[model samples]
Target: MQKPLLVTDFLDRARRYYGDHEAVVATTGERFTYDEFGERADGFAAALAERGIEKGDRVGVLDPNTHYHLEAAYGAMQLGAVHTPLNYRLTPDDFEYILSDAGVDAVFADYEYAEKIEAVRDDVPTEVFVTNDADAVEGDWESFDEAIETDAGFERPEMAEDDVITINYTSGTTGDPKGVCRTHRTETLHAYLVALHLDISDDDVYLWTLPMFHVNGWGHIYAVTGMGAKHVCTRGIDAGGIFEAVAAEDVSYLCGAPTVLNLLVDYYGDHGDVPTTGDNDVRVATAGSAPPEAVIRAVEDDFGWYLSHVYGATETGPLITTSDARRFFDDGSSARFGVKKRQGIGFLGTEVRVVDEDGNDVPQDDATLGEIVVRGNQVMDRYWNKPEETEIAFSDRIEGYYHTGDLATVDSDGMIAIRDRKKDIIISGGENISTIELEDTLYEHDAVADAAVIPAPSDEWGETPKAFIVPASGDPEAPGTTEEEIVDFTREHLASYKVVRRVEFVESLPTTATGKVQKYELRQEEWDDEDRMVGEG
Candidate 1:
């Protein structure tokens, strides 16, 4: 009854009980059983151990929603090595910073993103480079297919529940990226919570619409695998492909951000007669931002799939609250969409509170805005190599609670709705875009004097970055730079998703009495017509 909780146990249990069952449906039109998957993982672990990798070493994985990512992750975890996943959407510089900061020893990159890692290979500490397709990459990388063919075996080191097993780097706000260190206990509990709330089972078929790098696919990597569920992999998100896959593979469950829902809704509107589901009933979970009531209605009514809205941050297991409280609303009534729009009660064993600046819980009046804070076993233990930042994150406005920096209001029924973001970051299409990084990039331009970035409403993406610029010529009518030029400049420097979509030139920016730029003024003006202060809802 007191056995230590470890992430490796998930795969081990699945291998023992579900070895004969189908474990994965690869994007390459191939299927594998649990026994084959386990054998490949063990071979990969053997290869790493032969290459001098040991326990506590960082092993990086850079891939899309593919079976290779799952294999690489479990293989790293099997040898008690830290599994570090990198976002595929990030640029070469972002990868450089993350790989260097994490001190990754060995890395497995997909062929499509291998060139980015190759661009900064010398700068990072990574030694053993592996890719899915060595023929497609430019670097001298080992092939994943050959690497997993080794017949040798590796000895798994004994690990405790408190040992760090993973390091997920956060999207930096105003500074360098911070690695959120998670232990075996936190991951195991979070997986249990996800499986309970999402209702995953052995017969369920899971679609990898969500990226595996996103907080370990919102902890579904463990939850689904531990339950012996079938995984259907996809390389990228496409509305037509998702529909086709669901109908073909009989997908029962999936998760995505609100932007993915919008894409599906738009596709369904155009192709009215397209098949939405197969023989099995489908249930979807959406998060990252609140969806519009109309979108939620379209997903439930037109698509005929149940939608659950959840909320959390990368540091909080990315799933602390869910809006699936069936007791509060009748599914037959139109009022159910309103309840689903709020980030409902906290998950079991998780304490979610909206507190004021003085570390006191705010009244459940549904009008007073307060920062959302969370305390749970699934929360991160600390930030890697950054003691000061770690202390500030948990100690800000309260002790032992991770400050979410999201301002929200709690209703009388304990349902919380986000009103605004206290931080200067934009969540565009579920990707975090730092305004400071964009501003710094813009300042590098000769025609720009001062710039302020904020989130703007978008029907497609929940939010997009909008920049307000002060021209060096001190003239709003005839700024030295063009909006297209500013947007193009950001595209050249930052990642594709972080590019500025809207730009307005001004004579001078609105500043406070102390000469600090007032970004709230820009945000208020931009979101004046919206019902909520933040994006989407």
Candidate 2:
């Protein structure tokens, strides 16, 4: 007999087999077993049902990497409601847009970030508001602790594998943020691939350094939980806290972006004698952007932990390719860093290809630049409420495959390495920042006449936004705006990560004969000292 692949089965299996095992190590030092976690999720589901949240309702979870996020996500999923997670780093305006766009019925916010949601409560369509601490918030919010203490009950809704259960919002590249709808089968199969590729097991102690809001923690929320692994929760990213957690909890596995690895490397450089691992063998997976080979070398040799580099976007599973191919390099050899530096091979059952504009495969000569496209079971079904955008995303330059908008090259071994970005998106500190948005924001300032934003090489962030501006006065020397002022203006309007860190005053922006701004020239000028415009590797 065949079985339907549902995301709820992950938690159910853990509760059935590992009920007595410790499942969560909360940031406050509290521990909860699988049985206790399941009960809390059930209680949350019951409360949602009481609040008129039906099977197709959208539930928003705004929290960090705390146990509350896991509880809220699973709780909504159990009731067949869409699990929508919001980035805690976003501003109140962004929150308003996402909440209104997704039509979120109810929201469960962490005490620290509930105020942001409360600021936009009157603007959104959400009816029920809940937070971990009702007293800390100055709104009509329900306390999560009290809500789960009731005798109310909820029933599981019969769901098909193709029913959309989650909606992850993209970081508004060209316009308003688009919700990427994912179904139960896509999530479940992605978890299985993650488990198989990352070598996750029940005995492994997984650390929560990556934010659970990022592609559902890049699907680790299901992969690790389904494996019955121990989750070591964290409030935020701290180098000292990370090392301490590894030592204290005996963490065996974790995942992060290249920014996290840079932090660890810099921290180790300052404190050379810090502990890097615990009793179990440590395996770290990195995505978002490729890490420099030097960083990868230091991680493997100095930190004594294995690093696997993966790649994908939010539209895909956020992990369609990995660099963990052990056959390419011998164990403990220096050549492995070069192999791992590439995005490497596609995951099993995932078809990743470097294609030209004509929808034909590029040669595997490792020098031909082509756009990376992918087709997999883990890819999203469609964009929420945007059929035109969905059609363009899947049909642009190819048919039935998600266009990553990332340029890469394939070696003779079919391993792909990213070279440049096709989209006007700057990936600073592993967060996507749309250059068009920054340019638009700059145009709002009275001192700026013309502006173009590009990715500049950042040693710490891997990539930082650099803006070239033409003064309204038509004189570059006496521009009305200061570099610091432009940066401050962006911080006030946009998210912190999307702020432009570097600014250059110019008399005229490089433009084509047709009067269009030539951003490629600006990028080349900004990244002249770097190996590639994309990232270090």
Candidate 3:
């Protein structure tokens, strides 16, 4: 009676067990059942087969978080074709690089992002183009909806657990972005790990706060669907819209980055009387940035939502570690709540260790600094079409482990605390300034909505810390928020070298597709004239 472990098998099971259960709710007030979802996925699979899509073909999807995206992703998996979700916000050149890099054979895009594909369609080798909107269709493009109107369902391809299912492109902080190919085996296991950590169940109504393009939407698309849980899709991250959806859709669980959590807390503070449909509390799982202790405490105390923190990168299936305070904080003390802000221990299926330069494990005393390395089934299969880079990534400077390029320390209690990115640490005036540390302190300020700390060149010091801020609600154009105020805030909490030397107010911090603040981009402008790419770590 054991069922197959493939993603398609999960979809079919959901259809049978929860056939009449609602699956996806769109912002436009449209809803689909598990049965309807399976039918649409099957229809799309047949449509792709009709268009000559076969096993191993690379199909790129460029769309926002929509019901169609889920259908297309599962459909491609059914055909054994690799589903590559492109970030719709990428520039034209970035899109061109990825399309050509992956050698995508077909592209399924939303009408809003069709123009980006059209601009580089000739440069890339994509042959077939499918768009969601008929009115925006251009030359040689087919209607995505019309193509799937046929009643016949395509036969599921014979797929092994190890077959590659998705290719996720890295954010490319240093140079060109690398395509990280993930196998079905890894994806399936990662989903289980996430679901187990978050305690997902059939009654949980999950929301799509994270983009589907980012690590398979933190793998909830499979984990939630595998449990036959309902998915509430949000078109975008608007404060009012998310609140309304959470209450109206009866959302019980959601995953987001620290930025998303910050926005939610800000929204709830400004607009009181937000209502929830059910008695069960909403649980939020956040990552991407190490959330400030203040934000974590606020989400738990003010909003009355249970909060969990996790840490991982794109190459690690993005769920290698989680911080579950409940297991350790049974005493329910405020100090235990503060400990929840740490990245915590590795997930069940992963092995994490802090190693020195010689690849030796660091002491568990919590003071010894070392690189956080990981090995797991969730690790990416390889960098697509780049064997040399793949080898470098897997077996480069560190030997067997996949170098996370992040610095951390493990406490005696086995909790892992992230210090900073290997490249984000600044050495100025013979002292080290962790940009992450400085930024975390700055975020505790009441007026700061978001903060990014980068290294700026200085005449006296090799490099100094510079803070870029997004004001919480104050007017940037009018007279508000002096640099001295922020400097004073940082000084009260940090050492002299760690204090921000320069401050620039901006509307928003530049973020990667996965919601990580792209600190390298900010450092680029400062280090443009410098000879070296970066100072010694």
- For model 3 the TM-score comes to 0.95
Error of 2 at 225 (Å): 0.8
Q: Per-residue CA lDDT of candidate 2, range 298-338, in tens? A: 88888889898888878897789998899899868888877
Clashes of 1: 0
Q: lDDT per prediction?
A: 0.88, 0.88, 0.83
**Model 2 root-mean-square deviation:** 10.7
Worst lDDT window (10 residues) for model 3?
472-481
Candidate 1 C-alpha lDDT tens digits along 1-537? 799999999999999999999999999999989998888889899999989899999999999989999999999999999999898877899999999999999999999999999999999999999999999999789999999888788999999999999999875543466899999999999999999999999999999998898889989889999999999999988999999999999999998776578669878877879898999899999886566676788888888899999999889998999999999899878889878988889999999999999989999998887899999999998999999988988989999899998888899999998765676568888876767567767767878766788999998888999999988677978887799999999999988998999999987776421123567778778989999766751
Off by over 4 Å in 1: 173-175, 424-537
Scored by Cα lDDT, where does model 1 land? 0.88
Better of 2 and 3 by TM-score: 3
